[model samples]
Target: EPEVTQTPSHQVTQMGQEVILRCVPISNHLYFYWYRQILGQKVEFLVSFYNNEISEKSEIFDDQFSVERPDGSNFTLKIRSTKLEDSAMYFCASSLTPGGEGEQYFGPGTRLTVT
Candidate 1:
């Protein structure tokens, strides 16, 4: 089966800096999402994107966070200003349909370490 892939599996950045994590989801999927796990916490939804617009976002997806599809095959999550609490394992997920009804496939993850 095809799988989602992410670049720079590990990232370290200083507080207040900007970072962009990149992902390439399965070619045929339609819905994409960004989620994060803070240390030992449960996975938290950050944002969801579909058809070039945001579908939904959680409280955690503040103005500092953004998602984009710069090209048909690439999806990205940008953190404009990193905070210590922003450190987490960021995951990229995709599905054939909206997440509530379809199975989402997740990438390995990009571990962000904000200092």
Candidate 2:
């Protein structure tokens, strides 16, 4: 079965640098989302995109963050400027909205560490 794949598995960056995390969502899926967990916190939704525009976004998706479908299969998240609080496990997810239950399938995640 096809699955979402994330790169680097782990990343380390300086507080003021930029970082681009990569993901390949399930081949046949449509809805894509990014969520983060700050070590022991709940999974917080960052943004959701569909039909080439953002469908919904949370307050955490500030000016420093962006998402894109760079190609047919690759989805990426870029943090323009990192901060120490930005460190977290960035998860890329996708799901089929079969009746709107929204059971998303998540990638292993890219653990971002800012120093």
Candidate 3:
């Protein structure tokens, strides 16, 4: 059984700093996405990457946010700058698009704390 994995399960940073969250999904999965959940708020979609390019993105994915697959196995999400409001739980998910009805598998998630 394969699953998505993330590093630095917890991170604490100060405002104006930069942070890069890492994730590794099942090798065969075709679609990857990043989402964030603010404390007591709904989960918000940030971005989705497929075929080495962004397939879909939400308004929340501003210029400060970027994602990349540096190798065949690793996917990364980099936040150029951290803001106090950025504190949240960031999740990485992947799915196998067998017939376009893909059910995503999510990682444990990285909790970001900004002060």
Q: Against the true structure, whose TM-score is highest?
A: 1
Inter-residue clash pairs, candidate 1: none
Spell out the clash pairs found in candidate 3.
none
Ranking by TM-score: 1, 3, 2
lDDT of 3 at 53: 92
TM-score of every candidate: 0.98, 0.95, 0.95
Task: Give the C-alpha miss distance for residue 58 in model 2, angstroms.
Answer: 0.2
Off by over 4 Å in 3: 98-100
Against the true structure, candidate 1 has what lDDT? 0.97
Which residue pairs collide, candidate 2? Answer: none
TM-score of 1: 0.98
Q: Clash number for every model?
A: 0, 0, 0
Candidates sorted on lDDT, descending: 1, 3, 2
Question: What tens digits encode model 1's per-residue C-alpha lDDT throughout 2-115?
Answer: 999998799999999999999999999999999999998999999999999999999999999999999999999999999999999999999999978989999999999999
RMSD (Å) of each candidate, 1 decimal: 0.5, 1.4, 1.5
Best-matching candidate per lDDT: 1
